[model samples]
Target: MLNRRQLITSLALSATVLALPAPGLAQPAPTTRIVVPFAAGGPIDVTARILAEAVKGTLGTVIVENRPGAGGNIGVGAVAKAAPDGLTLGIATTASHGINPWLFSKLPYDPAKDFAAVTQMLRVPNVLVMNADAAQRLNINSLADLITYAKANPAKLNYGSGGTGSAGHLAGEMFKNQAGIFALHIPYNGGNPAQLGLLSGQVDFNFDNLATAAPNIRSGKLKALAVTTTQRAAAMPDVPAISDTLPGFEIDTWWGLVVPAGTPVETVRKLNAAFTEALRSPEVKARFATLMAEPAPSTPEQFDAFMARERTKYERVVKLSGAKVD
Candidate 1:
């Protein structure tokens, strides 16, 4: 009954109306699982649990699952291959996201390509600690003293770390190369065992996480030589920076979140906003403080850039140390 032009207009309008979402459109409830690529009580694990608690209200129910193996590769690879529906996410670190690819001959997932950058969570210094008795025996109270002792003893001095390609190992190797010392490297399955090795005097020293090493350092069971940060850590104000002795020596482990690549931009933004807000919460702040980690926040883009820089830095360190995963 209508003219040709009117008929076409009516048909077009009907199609557009059909395409539009219904009024009061309901979005599916958010159910998120945060994957930590390390064992419980480790740096990445601690941070992930803190974030999980903080973001629970925002994400409906935030859960943390540990899938530790291959120096955090197993858990990270799981997230990389997960659905990009804002449900499964990963709490990534230098080992899982930056250092693993270059150190391993082949990685299960592409660090840069397989995941979406969420936000930089926190940064913690690497502490150089020695057994209480060993510290006294070697007369090593500071970085200078350690260097002097190492130079005199050469290969007699040894250190332990989490694993071959871990940040702690690379940091110790850098210290050895820069200071021109010949300290033996003793690699262990994890930081706890490495710390035990140091405590038992099986190893002369260890470059360990501030979170993991703080209690031992505080208890006077171990002597703090220095921290691997550009500036002295607020938690260990008396301890000097390693850079003080070895110029340009700065290696700090960092943690952040990443989602599967190709996730919707809106979802990424939502996650970034929620997580960043949670990072600023008072409870999380206190938790990080107790763990000797400096609470850090960054935009998604900033986190991406940080990861890139970390990858380059660790790549060079791995080459210098001749480090590879066993």
Candidate 2:
């Protein structure tokens, strides 16, 4: 019933329709999981959540999971062992990547070999603080005063840290080495307990992360002497940097992203672009301001070099402090 030309045209059209892709058959977007090596509600965990939320539209269905234990080694080790598919990533901190290698007797994963750096996310400065009453009693109003008093009193002054090899501990030790002063070191189970020690006058002073100590400092329970960074913290502009008093003194607890070492370069680039965009967002910047942390996004190569430098610096601090987890 049909002419030959019409029949041929209909068959060709049918072939073209069948060759087109079906919408229902398209592959689903992969889910991304970001592991935080600290407990929920901590600074690193909070930062991870913020980043996950910011990147959701770009990266699709990103989630944050907390796996806290063994000074962040457990979660980081899990990430190190994850498939190098770029689906499982981690939020790495100064303690996890920089100090742990030197402090632990045996790390489950090698920092350099097991993971690829994505980008440095943020940097939080530690503050040197004393109990309000203690500072008033000792008439120490500044870092210089504390240093002079410690040099004069020697073992009379004591400092508290979260524990051995914590960023706070290493900061205290580094201060001691640079200042030529001696203050007895007291290691508590965690940062909160160490802060409690300082608040109750059990410890003379402490180096605490500004994120955790900002509330107390604002409430007048703690007196901030200086921030442990090269420059003054935006959150506490009135407080000077420790470097202002002790030339060339700086220690900051920074965090970044990393994936298993064998991940494809294209996948790493995609992640870096997403996170860097999030870091530059005004919303993320405002939230970080509330935490007294600064957004410090870096390229993958830059982050790798930064971590290497940090490792070298902390190795010296650990050796001088004689800190070991074994």
Candidate 3:
């Protein structure tokens, strides 16, 4: 009943309708929850917020949830029990994945079995910082100088840490073991207090997170002797690494993303891609610089392997230090 042009128009309309996706067939928008297993204001929480902001464009409705307590086990356990639909993810730190297993007598979730690695997010170096005045008095300008002074004074020099078995505590112990030097260890309730002790000269030095100590170091309140990492930190390139003096000495905190195990491989890949891309973006990189951290994106497989190595390393350190908690 129609002319040739009209018939062709009808056919085209039919084809277009057929090509359109059905309402229920289209993919629904995803709401992802990123759980941080630490207090809200700490480095891990800040990193989570930054990552949430960075990936919002690619992954819709990203949110960061803070669950602090029991040295990060409580929140991490919640993530382990989360639905493996890729909607629930968590930030895994060296403390959570590497240290806690050995530090604690029991954990609600197994770090190795409960979650699948999404990607490694960042790495933050620890710096050995001393009171500027104390360093000046001791004539200590480098790790070698610090070592020389500590060796000469044996137990006269004392270090402070957030607590027993913390990264700082372990780092100090490791240094003692590696350098064959002895110094007293003073534990504070938290890193801030430990750093305060260092500033007040209550303690001789601290293995402080570079981000937290950068301002003080810049302000000349604290003198950075060496970064705990084997390599110098980008945030403080002028500071040498402790390994330069004591070979094989390295201790730094790192964070990564993980999802509950049994998450679809495709979903994990998508998450890895989104986060890695976000980490690679200039804005995120700049922000990490401010935090004295480096964006270290990696594949799921790579992250898994890295965590395994970290666990083994921390186990040895914990054993060596005899650090244990209930």
Candidate 4:
């Protein structure tokens, strides 16, 4: 359990970590692995890699292993079932850490009780886009146009989601629920494949992160429709926000670090310090700037609170979306 004092304390909590007897805790050559729940090249993996490299000097030899599957539940479940040792950590993302709890009827791991929060890393807004040619044909230059089209041709229009219970999927579902529209959903193996489906004309639209869609949008392969964030992102200032079309429609993905539940209190403190320090580094900040995501460092307590709020928010969205694991 997190104490208010511990949550509000801004001091480097890592210094207080007890040096548990790991294989190389004393040696300078210890290795640590950070498991990313999503596939490589996504925001979660990208941020984990960047932070891992930045903290390698302080946290020993850092490595990232991708175990993407089941809308990120498989990788996250791995962390949940892993030993509560300091060596095995996980990159917690919105789909895995936040939304899945509400979406899945029987999750292998409890999002609130089965993991230890380390530090909050970054928050990214999702981009809504369509293939350029499709955009031109539909004349759907804005979010308003898309909504109108969906309303006019409910069953004919559809959107792509990373998977049945993924963040992008839920964001689209939430949009449909809020706007009173019905768009067919086409789930893919991952965001990359979902984006590909949209690009190849297999799907009409996709809601994904700016980092994933930026290149396509810039190259005129995909046209930017709107961002799921309430405010316009610095990376795409000219694009309108989903909130602009439907008020109170904000659904951004947040990422963080966590360990298996029951990790020694001291180890959690040490890991938090390494992550917080990593977030403050110039290199990590530069990477976040490029991704159009902001690094948000928080105490273990604050991370816990953030996850709680996310759990509540996504529960409503999930129930509305009628999501379930297969």
Candidate 5:
């Protein structure tokens, strides 16, 4: 019923109002991706999923994607090449960040240069476990006993590890150097095989992840000599640390959150805040306990420094062990 001019004016005002966003309403956040460089259901993937859930309130919508391959190079490389908008992040690990730089001659991504460390998520201590029967047969009841036996026997005592350049292999190399014992190195296809070999007495001992070795240790199939962490693991408080006898001897699996290097400092700080908060939560603590992992959240500066030290340590171990993937 209005005149043409009035109708036009009303229509224009209505369009303008529709175009403006509501005063208090916020736009939906884009989904953030945590690229886990491992297969689904593995420890790293599980950790990423847990973190994704923990940070949901702060990060809005976060998802975990598994892009495992090439000893985590493919997935990590994907993160390295991703747009530095903080939308894509990575779960960088000891393997990807610490050892791979030296192990793989032609690494797909530069661990130090391509990513900004947000915070260290957790550490999974590796235990030196001997087959129960072998331990009993050799009279090796503790780390001291094993080191003494190896020193006396020299190259006669053999240890199995997850391939030549694996974390286990590097840990073994460090152990030999620190303990001054000579044990033959037997490389297996992977961790499972290495553990299997140790269980069957194919090898005398193994530097195995605490989570996978805990059940066997409880069942008396494997005798835990010591954890490789500087301190004893919470899940197995009775066990001693290798560092207890060989001070400065520390080799453990660890992982943390990282974003592309070019991401703005503001975005990096925001991510670090969210992830460190999640790592400090009691729910995350309990969940990590179930995995036999210890949360080790740290500031961006601390994480970068930690990674630098880790890489330097691995450089020595890898060279001494002569481990190569090229």
Candidate 6:
């Protein structure tokens, strides 16, 4: 039905259309990946997964890659060494960002220099708890009484922790230093066994993670004396903070998001905005509560300052405790 000139023009138009990509065949959106420097099924990994889902609209398809090993050095170090693009990010834990630099003689990454902080994700408060029977037997109803008893009865009390360099062990050391008392430290294989040891009366007290110890505390098996955070944890407002008695005494496990150092300020701001917003969302808060973690979002500057203070504090505590990576 077409004349020769019309047919030639139609053929040229069809050829041009064929040269361009169709809508469906256009390039797929790029994905952003966050590396969780811990094993899967853990709270850090869960947090990363939650953020990944929450930021899908802003960040496209976000992927969570778990690269856990060597006290989280393997994965976190990778992040430190990664390209400074916002595409690759990592979760920095208390051990990874706060303690590892001092614990290890040589570290793969410098906590202070290697990563740009996005924001503090959450803090899991470690609590000071005693066995119900032990507290009752010793008439230790309060932190003040515990400190007094520990002072009067030198080396008469003891505690258990997950391990020598764990948050619990360091908290115990801080307690001894600040309160001017002595309490024997028994380091179990892990937190569970340590909690079990406390439950079975193998150890008199422990600076235990609130999440694992909460049920026991509620069940009257363990008596919570104080939380290690400066402020009382939202999960347990009734319990007082140890800072109330021993000024400036604080210790806990925490984690946050970080990108490799040298990442552009704009990229860092984007990541901070996405994650901090996610942390503020109601659904995210609910999920964090399920893990007994309180969202402690902060600006990048605040996170950096906090990490510096933590590192300085832990340097003294770790040295005083005489704990080193094995």
Worst 10 residues of 3 by lDDT: 21-30
Query: Deviation in angstroms for 256 in model 4?
Result: 1.0
lDDT of 1 at 47: 78
Model 4 quality (TM-score): 0.82
True-structure RMSD, every candidate: 7.3, 5.6, 6.9, 12.1, 2.9, 4.1
Candidate 2 residue pairs in clash (backbone atoms < 3 Å):
none
Q: What tens-digit string does per-residue lDDT give for candidate 2 at 1-80? A: 88999999999999999988887897668999999988899778889999999999998999999999999999999999
Residue-wise lDDT of candidate 1 within 1-326, one digit each (tens)? 99999999999999999988899998767678998887787667877888888988888788889898877889889998999998998987878777888898888899989989989999988889889899898777789999998888778888999888778899988898899998989999877899999988999899988878888888999999899999999998999999999999999988888999999989999999999998998989998888788878889999999899888988888999898764
Off by over 4 Å in 4: 1-29, 38-42
User: What lDDT tens digits, residue by residue, belong to model 6 across residues 1-326?
Assistant: 99999999999999999988887775766788999988899888998899899999887899999999988999999999999989999998888877777888888899999989999999999899999999999999999999999989998889999888888898899899999999999999888999999999999999988998999999999999999999999999999999999988889889898999999999999989998999999999999898899998999999999999889988998999999885
Best by TM-score: 5
**lDDT per residue as tens, model 3, 110-219:** 99999999999999999999999999999998889988888898888989999999999999999999998998889999999999999999999999999999999999
| Backbone clashes in model 5, listed as residue pairs | none
Candidate 1 regions off by >4 Å? 1-28
TM-scores for every candidate against the unseen true structure: 0.87, 0.91, 0.91, 0.82, 0.93, 0.91
What lDDT is obtained when candidate 3 is compared to the true structure? 0.93
Compared with the true structure, model 3 gives a TM-score of: 0.91
State model 6's lDDT.
0.91
What do the candidate models score in CA lDDT, each in turn? 0.88, 0.93, 0.93, 0.86, 0.94, 0.91
In candidate 4, where is summed lDDT lowest over 10 consecutive residues? 10-19
lDDT tens readout by residue for model 5, 164-183:
99988889989998888899
Q: What is the lDDT for 120 in model 2?
A: 98
In Å, residue 201's CA in model 1 sits off its true spot by 1.7
Identify the runs in model 6 with alpha carbons over 4 angstroms from their true place.
1-20, 23-26
